[model samples]
Target: MPKAYVFTRYGGPETEAFVDVDRPSPGPGQLLVAVHAAGVNPVDWKQRTGYRRPGESDERVFPVVFGNEVSGVVEDIGDGVEGFAVGDAVFGTALAGGYTEYTLVPAAIAAHKPAELSHTAAATLPVAAATAYDGVRQLDLPSGATLLVTGAGGGVGAAAVQIARAFGLRVVGVASEGKKAFVESLGAEHVASGPGWAERARASAPDAVYDLVGGQVLAEAAELLTDRTKLITAGAPEEEVRRLGGARVARARNAAVLEEVARLVLKGDLDPHLTETFPLDRAGDALRTVEEGHARGKTVIEVTR
Candidate 1:
């Protein structure tokens, strides 16, 4: 039996626990991975609290693992899988959960981890970086155009700012005052989040807005863009964005997107700096940090340790 940190039911941290279970076998189009590192996102904890995606079902699987993106060695190849080997270093969206020592990945979404990129960094890509890359491309802002990204200090927002800059777009990032330096380091003009952020962004005269913070921010950021087609959000509900004449972040959840993000990392265009790393035993604490919205960039669990 292998040990994994899982939530016994859909609830709070009290529903979570460490349990031993049989190692999962790869299914068709899947690969079993020896987990090395896993990224912690707000969604991980949100799902545990019974939050479901827009199209997701109301299904319950007890003792479910919590992680969504991970990096590790390929241990076994499933039927019909190609371009992957038994020992390949890979990273992708986890099919089961990533808190364990081993998990499964759908080959359609996984990519080979380049030798130059660390597993920890690779783990952060499948979700945050990939989403950022997709949303920026979806916006299709022209060169020299100014792009505004709200929630620009977190994992996905940081990647969005960098990738937008790499593509020749000027970026203005909104985050807490404490993260002004960090956001500016990613090549975006820092706009302190809180009162009057819209006015500060107006001072920059942005052509597009990529929002990672939802609610009223999405509505206000929408006002920044007259075209409305250029406004998108990964954090807000589709209906909310649509109400503002904007749209949700459209995802291309395939291996090609993963490869594109990896290339960006290798080309010095993007970085997934794991500001915090915790051992498997402290997985709960790791989730708490992100769940409480205290994570500056990204936090990951190193299961191999």
Candidate 2:
């Protein structure tokens, strides 16, 4: 049996608990990984609340684990799996949850963890950084074009800023005053998020916008773009974005996206900046850090040595 932090049922913190379960073996086209580090994302909490991502099925068994991205060494390989072998270092989105000592990763979504990347850094890529890469590449803003990112202080926002900068796009980032230097470090002009953020972003004259904060923030960011197609959001609902004449950032979740972000990390163009880490027993605290919106860039759980 292996220990895991999980939510017994769909609810809030009350539903989350620590439990033991049989170590999962990889099925066809999957790889079983000895977990080292796992990235904590907002979605982890959302999922605990019974909120499911689009395209995710309703069929799920509970005491579901609490992480999405994980990095570790391969322990076992499933039937038909290729390009991976036991003892190989790897990281990717988990097939179920990541807050455990061992978990299965579908071969199509996992990639080798490069020698240049540590488990902590590799853990951040599959979700936050990958989403940034996908959206920035999807927008494909022209060189010298300006891009605005709301909620620019968080994990996904910071990554978007750096990735957009690496591609030669001018970036304007909106965050709280406390994160000005952090956001600026990513090569984006920092705009304080508050009453007049829309005006501040307007001053930057963005040609495109990436909204990482939903609700009013998404609506406000919508004001900065004349071309709705040039506006995209990772935080808002499809109806909300559609009402504003824009669309959500369509994600291409695969090994290719993970590999691209890893390349960015190795090139020194993308740093996940994991500011905090918790051990397996304190996995709840790691999730709480991101859930409380107190984390700067990324938070992770170190599940093993």
Candidate 3:
């Protein structure tokens, strides 16, 4: 049996618990991994409260493990899986969940970890970095064009700013005043988030907007882009964004996207910015930091062997 953090049923932290369960076996096209690190994101907490993506109707079987991405070594290969072997270091979107000592990863979305990148850094990529990459590419703004990024201090936002900059686009990053320096360090002009933040961002004369914060913030960002197609969000539902004449970030969840982001990391154009890490026993605290919306960068759970 393996110990995993899980939510017994959808509700709140009270529904969550530590339970011992049989280790997951890889299915067809999947690989069993010995997880070394798991990335914590807002979605992990949101799911505990019954949040699901648009069209996601698969009923959750409790006690569901908690996590979406991880980096680790391969333990076993599933039927029909090729290009990977036992002991190969890998990282990807977890098929089951990632917060346990072992989990399954779909080979289609997983990539080999380069020796230079640490497990902590690779763990943050499949969701946050990959989402950022997709949204930025979706905008397709020209070089020297200004791209305004909302919620620019969190995991995905930080990655978006850097990737946009790497693609030769100028960036305007909106975040709390507390994160101004951190956002600026990512090569974006920091716009303090609050009343009149969008007005202040107008000074940058953005050609596109990459939104990670939904609701009113997204509506405000929408107003800044006259070419609505250039406005994209990983934050809001597609209908909401499309009604505003924008679109949601279309994810290309494949190993190709994972490899591209890894290349960006190796080329010095992106950093996962793993700002905090906790041991497996403290996974709840790590989730809370992101759920509270105060995390300055990516948070990870470092599972010690």
Model 1's lDDT to the true fold?
0.91
lDDT of 1 by residue, 1-305 (tens): 78899999877889999999899999999999999999999889988988776777858678789899999999999999999999999999998899899999999999999999999889899999999999999998889999999999999999999999999999999999999999989999999999899988898888999999899888889888879988899988889898888898888999899999999999988878679999999999999998887888889999864
- Candidate 3, position 161, lDDT: 96
The RMSD of every model to the true structure, in order and in angstroms, is: 1.2, 1.0, 0.9
Clashing pairs in 1: none
Q: What lDDT tens digits, residue by residue, belong to model 3 across residues 1-305? A: 88899999999888888999898889999999999999999889988999887778899999999999999999999999999999999999998888999999999999999999999999999999999999999888889999999999999999999999999999999999999999999999999999999899887889999999889999999888788888888888888999999988988899999999999999999989989999999988998899999798899999999
**TM-scores of the candidates in the order shown:** 0.97, 0.98, 0.98
Candidate number with the higher TM-score (1 or 3): 3
lDDT of 2 at 136: 94
Q: Model 1: number of clashes?
A: 0
Compute the lDDT of residue 290 as modeled in candidate 3.
94
Candidate 2 lDDT by residue in tens digits, 1-305: 89989999988899999898899988999999999999999889988887777677776798788889999999999999989999999999998889999999999999999998999889999999998998899888999999999999999999999999999999999999999999998899999999988987787888998989989999988888889898898898788899998888899989988888999899989989889998999998888899998999999899765
Model 2: worst 10 consecutive residues (lDDT sum): 51-60
